[model samples]
Target: MTDQLTQVIAQATLKDGMRNSTDSLDAATHSAKKLARKLFEGLDEDKGGVLTRDEFEPYFKNPADAAEAFKVFDKDGNGDIDRKEMRNAVSRIYRERRALATSLKDMSSAVSKLDGVLLGLALLITIFIWLFIFNPKGTTAQLVPMATIILGFSFVFGNAAKNLFESMLFIFSIHPYDVRDLIFIDDSPMFVLEFGLFSTTFQRCDGQVIVAPNSVLFGKKYILNVRRSGPMWEATKVMVSFDTPLDVLHEFRTRLRQFVTDHPREWKGGLDVNIDFMQNQNLIQLSLIPSLVVAMEHKSNWQDWGARWDRRTLLMKEMKRIMDQLNMTYKLPTQPVSFMSGQNKSPKPANSLLGAR
Candidate 1:
């Protein structure tokens, strides 16, 4: 038992000695560092004066010192110092110094901003407390809560209200078309498929559907295609040689009108076939415009573009047939191109005057 107690005593004594040695060594190291710094500073000659620890100590005290410190760190030696540079220098000082003085100033500024926000909250709470305690039964209390509720509602649903309001206005004063009506926006043709309280939906010829806000449609210009409602007409240019007389154009127009009238399937009754003279040159260009209004009416293919295409194809075929009957030829405008093999005059004939000499 005595030997065991002695062993415990020795162990405890060794641990105590080691701990004391570590503490003494740490103290000696710190003192040595301080002495080294003092010796280094004493040996240096400050030919170029610089701000010392004491001189810079004041700026670490408060936010107002940002100006004074700016003047110190302005390496460009500008007479006027900027506040932003002062802030950057403060940040660098914290990094280089690793001391509590400059950090305390930054901590204080952050705490001040936080305190202001807390005070604002406290003011709001105080107003509520006063209202509840003193005027709980008054009309002002009732109106205030109602106003708050309305303001909150508007804040959350303002965009929805704007959309709905514009949609209703558009449906009344601006809407010029109905469902299935062909309309054009930005020169692109689209068929109206559906209308919503907030948006109008359009379907393209490719079967793709698009939905756009009503407000956008209301503010933009659109065209309602009246031709789609009844018969449709398209025009193309026909070219003929300049030798063709104006009488030929009139004759073609008469024959074309008669052919379309007889078909009854390709041409509408109200509008006649028109042949207008265009550019006149070596090649005479005539605008040949005919209608498929009667075809659309007789076929009653309101939404079938394929049926319309077939009607157009039939019209073109009839035009060709009528031209063949009238012995009228269709010409394409073309420019004659001449190529010179060389600058030499035209080659002499095989037995020309030059060969006879």
Candidate 2:
């Protein structure tokens, strides 16, 4: 079977004249299938019509042809062949031949590629011969030192160059995020300070600078928070004792929201402020931590980041003052643990819980 398959492939090579042809991998695979089918049709010893592994072993010498032949005839691809499938395989072979015969573009494309290959080879040989005859060894080396340098550089920095270029293209073309636009890269919130040719500069809240190579940034995805329709939202949160009246908390939140909404332009319009109850603010176990959420619009310097910071600082201060004015209970961190000593200690409803701590 192996020798017969080899002879069939050899006959196909001669019949199709692929030895001097510019056939693609698909074309070569098709040719192999044709050759296998041609050989299979002639095998009739101990065969029940369909070509199984046992029946196919008599004709398919090459493993590749055998595999391809099985795939061609296995129409339903259940890994076996039937009489109907074997018959249909003949039609497929005929159709493939007819299609190839009628495909002028395929023929032209093959011829054009063949011409190009031949011309390129001829030119390369001509240049090599001329260089050998007329050009000195030193002259050849000197002329191509630049090409060598470029090749050497590519070997060293090709990936970096590709990444940097892609990053630059992304920065300028896609505009993923711009300067002053808040973004998170690698879980760190950063303000984009500058976008450079090969790196990006970011400024953290502590005045520390972060210099990331463009390649590093390009390699990882980022969380981009930008505004198109309106000013970006800034969320603030503060925790307070549960002793604070719910009505007072609600009033404070309502006042803040109304203040921002009434003068929309001052807060950059469409001020959507929210204050909600939260579980213990800290992740560690604490129940009814009674947290206050704040989202308010403010008018301030977007460029300097002072507006948001100033507004946040002032709002925190005012909220603290309001809580104090209302005489709602709160505690200082350094307050002595006199209650622990039971010295002049009495049961105070507000101070009985961990909120005091």
Candidate 3:
């Protein structure tokens, strides 16, 4: 079966011009495998995995080749092919073809670009040889000094060029963010608007655009991609006086949960409310982490941001209503001040040498 399959694949490769007549056995075999998988799946009628000799005949000009292909595909000596057998036979073939195509495309691109450079190098080499053969002493004297200057110049500026090279690497390889993606750089949220080879343009929420080099972005502490993250909790902190009862805090949590439940579209199903901290026996800081539903269907991050902003306003308003219902008062910090009864009297001097004088 192996020998017959190899023969059929070789014949197909030759016919398709995928393998030249003078090609080595290994080269022909490798090329034959890529083209065979493309033909392997096309003959299946009724979208079924099995391919009888009749179904394979139209793909091949000769009936003998079709019969041979059926025997190779039909494992376990079963008259029909099943999905398992098809998977085992064609999966590796498809992978090899895809990999070979990608490698060839990359190689062709690299070689095409270098072709011009190589031609120019060849011309320069020919001229150099002619000059050396005719006037070796003078040519050597001139070339040595020219090469030294070029080396020194490169050494002086190579560090500066490294930044540009790193920028290219960041843009092409790391790919930290894409256009329209909402990312936080240095804790400031910005929307990516454009991507250049060496720099990226970002738009702040306040409508300011920043063009930062890729190298600079790569050096930041961290870049947070909001678009790639899950729904985030919107926190609202409130200070309540120590006199407030525990029952009131419990009621606030319950009401906040109910609000999230009622507005299912704007908020997620769950929430958290807790006493985050307490001041010096004065007030308790209550923290609410209300999970805001991410607007994934929006056209852009800006639209999503706007939608979240409105939802936050609604949440705050609902919170205010709940607080008003429970008669909850905010505990604002106070400062003590003293006023003198006699405004016209002179101020007292400090208790120092100046006061004694």
Candidate 4:
């Protein structure tokens, strides 16, 4: 079977003389699906057509770990994984592996830039030191004038020198964020564009460029590195009337879960739909917070901002559809109106109104 499958894939790749790039992509996808099928079949030792927890125990030493892995593969909480679910799980893993590879490449590029900058600085410093130590004209008296000039310049730019030193320290010691990293500065998402000795350049999702001094960023009490931390969790609240039927609420949660399940590539596996809070003071409104794994699509962390908003918008539209179909009622808080002691509750008679003829 393996030899036959390989032959089929090879034929698909080397098909008729008129093959194009799309043919190659199709062949690759076919090969991946075949491999996924093979893996799934191998795991079904009992030939039961579905994978059970026992089939996974040998690979995972801890029973709890095995159960968790099983749960991921079993998309419908069916306690067993069918061929279709296994294939989906395998595809997800493939995408994650590709994403990891891209992230590593980004890190490598960032480090290369850092190395180049450091090397340039080191060479410049070494040139000055070499000239001072191995001066062809070796008299201390000969260098006194140059030394005086250097001192004068240093004194004139003392503050700049201090900032340079501090910037160097920030680069070497802190290492909080890297080029192409998504970071939050003053609650705004900033994509690190270039890391310079004195200042760093950042770009916002809307394409605004910001150049901030290294001292300013380094002195901040906190920096949120979104990429290094992995995916973020975001929640959307839905306000519904407290009197909504239990069955309707159950269906609401089920539909949302189904949506997430249908888009495994866009959202993480699980979701949290719970009662967030209630407003009983002014109105009776129940807030249901459905927390999801923030959608971060691109290998570059900067793209996460756009992807997150896009996913949220999609989820909100889905929620609106579900609410409309279920006929769920959302209640708004009521406000009280107060009138002054002498104020007329009704408008003056039509004849007495301003500008009356």
Best by TM-score: 3
Candidate 1 per-residue lDDT over residues 1-357, each given as its tens digit:
224323323332332345236664454334434443442344223522333334343436664475555454442333332333333333333222322222333335434644675698699779877987888788465877878997998989888777656766786556566555556677676777666556767888778899988878776667655424555556676666667666766777777777667755335533344445545455666667766552222222234455567766776786677666656664665544444436686654544444578
Sort the candidates on TM-score, descending order. Answer: 3, 4, 1, 2
Q: What are the Cα lDDT values of the candidates?
A: 0.54, 0.52, 0.66, 0.67
Per-residue accuracy of model 4 over 223-270 as CA lDDT, tens digit each: 788867654556556678877787888898889888988876466656
Candidate 2, residues 36-119, lDDT tens digits: the string is 565456654555555665555545677777777667666444456655555445444443343333333333543464467569
Q: Which stretches of candidate 1 lie over 4 Å from their true place?
A: 1-139, 142-159, 172-175, 225-233, 270-280, 294-304, 324-357
- Residue 333 in candidate 1 has what lDDT? 57
Worst 10 residues of 3 by lDDT: 294-303
Q: Tell how far residue 55 is off in model 4, in angstroms.
A: 24
lDDT of 2 at 351: 49
Cα displacement (angstroms), candidate 1, residue 354, comes to: 17
TM-score (all chains, Cα) for each model: 0.46, 0.39, 0.55, 0.52
TM-score-better candidate, 1 vs 2: 1
* lDDT score of residue 22 within candidate 1: 61
**Tens-place lDDT digits, model 3, residues 1-357:** 235455544443342344334454355455445444444566566666566778877767799998887766554344666554454454333333433443444335434644655688699899989999999999998998889997998899777567656765676567676555688888798987666655677899999999887777766648888766776766788888877899988998899899888865456667888889988777888988877775423311223577678888888898899989988886666644433437666544344334568
